[model samples]
Target: MKHPLSQFNYCPLCGSAHFEAHNEKSNRCTECGFIYYFNPSSATVAFILNERHELLVCRRAKEPAKGTLDLPGGFIDMGETAEEGVAREVLEETGLIVEEAVYQFTLPNIYVYSGFPVHTLDMFFLCKVANTDSFKAMDDVAESFFLPLNEICLEAFGLDSVREGVKRFLKR
Candidate 1:
């Protein structure tokens, strides 16, 4: 799938096409002398489970993983802490209020769609839902439901980094 912002020929900084790859991390523009690099953005994910040990998963309503099951998460906004972002993303995507969470794991991965890099430093946390009755699909989510951990197919989700984090958490 093509990223929505992948059709640009000019540098975002100075609107020049005279750009050169500086390394695996960045690009340098010869025209306006601007450097563009693949900087890893921080993202937070939540593993919210019920008393039955079923994990809450949401069907993505947006790109990057549309139609696939994903743990509630999104980019950490500027000035927001990791914990704050995790809780906000969960509420925004699944309408589930999360409480009592602990950091589980951190994964570094790169997502490339249509040759554009989406480098992410993903932070995962295990949280308990405060009010399941409030759960409802919201922005960027088509639907939300719970599934047993063992029933979740990691390969089908297409989120290897998140799957690994869940696996590690379950193992411990």
Candidate 2:
């Protein structure tokens, strides 16, 4: 497949057709001297382990991997820290409130939304959910459930980063 920025033929700032690849990750407009950088976006994922040691996972409701197992998280919004963003995603996907969490790890991932592959920096967090009672699937999740850490099927996770992160999460 071609690079994701290949579609960006015109300069976004000046709407000039003189834009061309300036570097591996940026485009520069010769006419307007504008450079557009295709930087990786920030995303977050939560690893909420219940008292029984079952990790809370969700079935994706949207495309790119519908019905696949995923952690409760999403892209970090503007003005939110990774911790804040992760808690918001967990709340949106699983209806759980994260009281505390620690940044565990990070993984680079490709998130294909609307058929466009966007590079992302996925931040994984070890979260403490208040309780599992409010765990109702919503938002981007079609269903919410817990899987025993040992019995988790890594293949069920659709995202490569999630699969890798879960491996590290399970090991430690």
Tens digits of lDDT, candidate 1, 115-161: 56777899988888787656888998888888887887776565767
Alpha-carbon RMSD, each predicted model: 3.6, 1.0
Q: Give lDDT for model 1.
A: 0.78
Worst 10 residues of 2 by lDDT: 1-10
* TM per candidate: 0.78, 0.96
RMSD of 2: 1.0
- Candidate 2, 81-155: lDDT as tens digits: 999999999988878999997999899999988878999999999999898767899898899898898899999
Candidate lDDT values, in order: 0.78, 0.90
How many collisions per candidate? 0, 0
